[model samples]
Target: MGWLAAGEGYEIALVDGKVAARSTSGRSAGKQLKTLPKALRDHPEVERLRRFADWLDRHAASCVAQVDAWMVSALPVPSAVLGEVWADEAWQAALRDLVVVGAVGEGPDATGFLRDVSEDGELRVVNLDGETVRMSAETVTFPHPVLLPDLAELRDFAVELGVAQKVEQIYRPTWDKPSDPNQRSSATSEFAGGRYPSRFALAARAESLGYRVSGGYAVHRIRSGGRMVEARVWIGEPHREDDSVTGGLSWSSGGRHLPLDKVDAVSWSEGMRMAAALYAGRTGER
Candidate 1:
């Protein structure tokens, strides 16, 4: 099949279980995807593509996580490691276009794009500024967006470099830490009373309120209390008929359950709003 374009200015295609986006126009069109119709989105083939896209995002995030750790822990990485992993296309793609700083003394933070490596494992960097610099450190860092002083300017720089991040990095909200020192979070929703004639209607109503349908759940993600949490309201278990009654919603962080009372303030309200929206759609045709 030919390329299926999703968001504006970009066409997404699956090649061997991997999703790749090619820019069709000069501008970024990430917002265009939010309008994808439910029917088209739920199509089997489309779902597969989205899964692949999500995988691509996770891969990029994994690379970033590793780099962030290397920076934070002051871990000493062998130069050979970079030379080795740099040859892997997946690793390279994840690392490409990210702002990388040397282990402090190696050099100032630079926008990484093109590079060359020595046979011995030393890496030479060519930044967005068209300047060539060498990092002599054993480790590198990919700092969080909130920690970057030149974040705004760097985003513009990324655009110039044709760095279209597959992950939600550019816009995903970040906090210095969770606002709640108690490390507690919970979510309560008024959507408990709503009933739906079908799962499609339930999902549609939630979508109207900006919740995303993931698998058998309608998911709402919120960043609060120093955590990125998700409230997943059940639409149905997989393989269930559209008429199935969904179970209660639940809150989680990093895949672990979050208590309803401990749910952060923002998460609590948004979760309730999503629940309320879905609840309103649940009707037995009465």
Candidate 2:
């Protein structure tokens, strides 16, 4: 994802040649706040997100434990609308039934865990229990709006838990179903600015947690079949944005695009390294 961004004209990739590193550098620090001290579990917003999470688990059962569907394109709605939205009797009723069925799970505190913190640092009240849930600035990290789920983590987890086949087949169907009416309305009507058209975003959290990487190349396409995904890329020297612009002007030369293919399921850096390896093969042979 990061490589794609670099290829398409995003100039801010880091100097380390690590795409994941560059992305984490650009995230809003607020996302780290998702972890609230246990003492604050009773906070309203925490309960709300918990409830929301439970609701998600219950209704989106197909996607609950799988990271394959990581890209959940959503609008950043103003904090004011959360209550009204959650207050929809039908939604609440569904939530209540979810709680009854143990699908929502037990809340550590009176407040649920699903929460949203306003930009002003105020807790918004959700209709789940009519309580104000607090937002933790520490746990919230605002990443690039286009990031997708880090499937590598899920793949590892599935292997560890021995659910690889079941999870892979169930959670990520061959095709995505149509958006629900409720889901469509939320995306179209109630989000910040407007709908986010970009469906995939790069995950920096996955990188910080020790996913290997190879990046800073250009990707032409991604091909997936029979449980394998391959990234097609091109190799070229890594140059700072300024170097490319000025050098191009001086020599009256445009950029050159190489033909390279990087393997998938490797860290972002490793992926780029694969591209470099291919490039080396051609040049060294010559």
Candidate 3:
């Protein structure tokens, strides 16, 4: 952004997402100041720049959140939508380098890291073969890591290419369900018994990590295999000052508790992931 006259001899503009000032005269003429000048602190131009910077930060965060939701839900996004938003810097930052697959159709069905979206809604991607390919599919999906067939290989290749994604994808941790029916239980106690100073502390930690606090549990909802599943970890009562401990992790569908054996893979992994994250924040862990 170009500098705007702020006060008497200073001009202000956004530098690295912050309001910066420069003198238009004297020894410091045209030199970016290390700090905003006191006179320009309350200037209308400076205030407006600060407000704009704040909006940019919020817009970037919102973009990442939306992309994260799409990845978690494995929703199909239209190619036209991608092209429409690709011009926005914040949206491009969040969508670039994400792994995407063409929705089942006659168009290119291969999985690759998204690179570009043309004005005509064509997608350019770096395929597993280390080749750039164009996909003209009507829609594409940002598959969850749990559903990616070549997740491990993709991680290694991403490292080789020095891919730094704004949204967590290839490097996101995952868990697998036990295949043996004998080992299944309605809920797992692996992350249970984690102590917290107070119920509020545990619940606050859950909320800080983007989980919803409900009743006595921290819940993470996932849509998998066309079913809505909720993974919940017991975090004790709502009493703010009452000491609490974490409890077993479980999954439910349509208000009915599900056996670990019956929970779908994505649901099972997400539930365990939430339980483990909550446990990791407990007090005095050895």
Models ranked on lDDT: 3, 1, 2
**Which regions in candidate 1 have their CA more than 4 angstroms from the true location?**
1-79, 109-119, 128-130, 165-286
Instruction: Judging by TM-score, tell me the better candidate of 1 and 3.
Output: 3
- The alpha-carbon lDDT assigned to residue 132 of candidate 1 equals 71
Tens digits of per-residue lDDT, candidate 2, 139-183, equal: 221111122243344334434444423122223322121245444
Candidate 3: minimum summed lDDT over ten consecutive residues — where? 180-189
lDDT of 3 by residue, 174-223 (tens): 88777776555634777898888899999999999999999999999998
**CA lDDT scores, all candidates in order:** 0.59, 0.27, 0.88
lDDT of 1 by residue, 35-113 (tens): 4444354455567787777877777668766654443233456666777888656666655554566665544533353
TM-score to true structure, per model: 0.41, 0.17, 0.93
Alpha carbon lDDT at 146, candidate 1: 57
Residue 16 lDDT in model 3? 89
